[model samples]
Target: MGGTNDAADGTYALRAVDPLIGELLAGLPALLLVGPRAVGKTTTAHRFARSELRLDYPPTAQAVAVDPDAVLRELDEPVLIDEWQVAPAVLGAVKRAVDQAPHPGRFLVTGSVRGDLDSPTWPGTGRLVRVNMYGLTVAELLGRAPREPFLDRVAAQGVEHLPTPLERPDLRGYVELALRSGFPEAALELPADLRERWLDSYLDQLLTRDLAMIGGQRDPDRVRRYLEALALHTAGVVEHQAVFRAADLSRATADAYDHLLRNLLVAEAVPAWHSSRLKRLVRTPKRYLIEPALVASVLRLDTNSILQDALLLGRLLDTFVMAQLRAELPLCRSRPRLFHLRQADGRREIDLIAELSGRRTVAIEVKAGAPGTGDARHLAWLRDELGDEFVGGVILHTGQLAYSLGDRLTAAPISTLWA
Candidate 1:
């Protein structure tokens, strides 16, 4: 799309991962790359812009602020606005500029949270196309190293056959992914103590800065507890009442806290996949960590701790599946809506139902380690129950090998779908 070279920005020089960057950069009028904090949104955006407009004096207040229109006029083309949600009012101005000039690649905007997650209004709508940026993928982890085994699979068979087979076990890659999480800074660094500090401060900033914007007035310590509660229960069906009970707060207060947490990008709730009126299907949705690392940080659970705690292990696996599904959807050039499935007889349940275009359904069940055929039994039951609606199934696990448990279902390592 855009003819700009990667050298347009020095930051790109250091970025080894993100195979989708070139495609994402040239997509639409305005490209909004939204992801959790420290996921390289600002770094990637600045690199895409190649240059940035620095403000000598930071504005004192967002409200009663200077007119962004006049200020943006002085900036160069293809402006990279870092932390746009910090001052979202400027986005409407950017929208107007793009509409008037009609440039394909003129502005790059990055936000940790959707500007209107609480209010439910993204200021720049038709003006910008949105893409998600997640933690470093295995491809990114390998950098320029000859294509990894998994990538070779994707290259040969295409992504459709991702679960078709598996070959080798790169334990080093698994360790790096587990230890590093998804944040770029930690992904590059190895020390646990340093990562601990980075995660602590990052969580603190989220509570103070981002949480405050969405109407959280509780004590920071208490808010931190609420986050920990959410982390412990990551990727499980949301029980607003459970959150309230844990924090010793009223229902209204707990609801407000959930909204605030989402607004800050600390968490997200995934809805159930029920297109029809199945009264037995769960109406309540599941919640997941925006980044898997937060769950580890909140639980104080590293790789070893994660393996030791059975319950925590399950949650971590679910969180990883969610992240992989979200990140890989973009690569496939498809927007996959992830949801859990449940049936009336209590006979069927699917951890993840990835509904692709033309009603193609890919069912998945996440497990802490190598999963058995029973994992896909629910999937088979679901397929039989839903008749033609249910498609093939997959059991994502911690195992090194990928193979079929039966005819309809297959098992794949969580690492296989890295980015």
Candidate 2:
């Protein structure tokens, strides 16, 4: 039960860890980095740009809104515009600027919220490129992203040579990680009480400001209830009707709220992976909170409380694993689309199915504890079903060892996600 979120000073520079995005920044004319607030998008973007306009600050946003062209012309090249969505008009200005002079490394935009759907601003569809930045992965947070390249190996070699050893945390350690969170500022010694207050305010702003900024609305109480309802279903496939029922809201309303959460990147929905022959698989997607700490906080679970609840702990651990995969996938040279799979008849389920390029697939089953071959039955079944199309399979657990489970299968420590 002892840990803190304080990150090293060097983390402020995104390039220090997230080289994938750094490399992209060099090539892309403009990069719009989107993520939930306090994940360090602004902090990282500032490290590269000569000047920044924080649109979340009212006067700065209004100045840009008054004359976006003037603001665009005045800012230096590779200008950083944090919270560009606050002034949607700036997008068109940026697009026009790009069209006039089609050069690489022109602008760096960072947004914690999106713009209104009905807003008149053009999205700069072809001219601007958008990439998401998530909370630090354990690997990036610990400064091992460059030195430890296992995820790349998983993508390229498919469990060939083994990965290096990793720290295997006990149950308490796992829960501590969840509490410490991946949010950059939160990771940096944000006190426990303040973290709670920050979450409370974050959710409030989402309902009152972020949603309205995007031409949306929801009952604050109802949305909270819906989130609580959704928390119970995290890491598993559940129907929309079920979520609506649990939240006591209309189907349309629940659907709308769900879409907003997705747009904000707070809720990550993993679609069911299927093939033409796998029509029997359930088509419903599994939705999880984008960060494990959010799941615990939404459910009001602390260390002691979570340790007492094995079932919830297991589900949260699955969310933890999937969230890490989501963050780690983009860093890979061959980025794969993440999905979840379940048989319609409920006979088997695979926690994660990553569809990589060339029709190759990487299947991962998340387990809270160390896994046995018996625990890998579903993973093996998937391997047999996919045959050669299956690049590899692994039972990712909170254990230290990374060993073969035979037939291109490996029992990998979950830490391999970022280590």
Candidate with maximal lDDT? 2
lDDT scores for all predictions?
0.65, 0.75
Stretches off by above 4 angstroms in model 1 are 1-27, 54-64, 117-122, 144-176, 275-279, 344-346, 386-389
Predicted candidate 2 versus true structure: per-residue lDDT over 42-118, tens digit per residue:
77777668888878789999999999989889878788988887888888888888888887888988887665533
lDDT of 1 at 352: 84
Best-matching candidate per TM-score? 2
Estimate the Cα RMSD of every predicted model relative to the unseen true structure.
5.0, 3.2
Candidate 2: misplaced stretches above 4 Å?
1-17, 116-121, 147-150, 215-217
Model 2 has an lDDT value of 0.75
- Candidate 1, residue 38: Cα displacement in angstroms equals 1.1
- Could you tell me which residue pairs clash in candidate 2? 5-187, 5-188, 6-188, 6-189
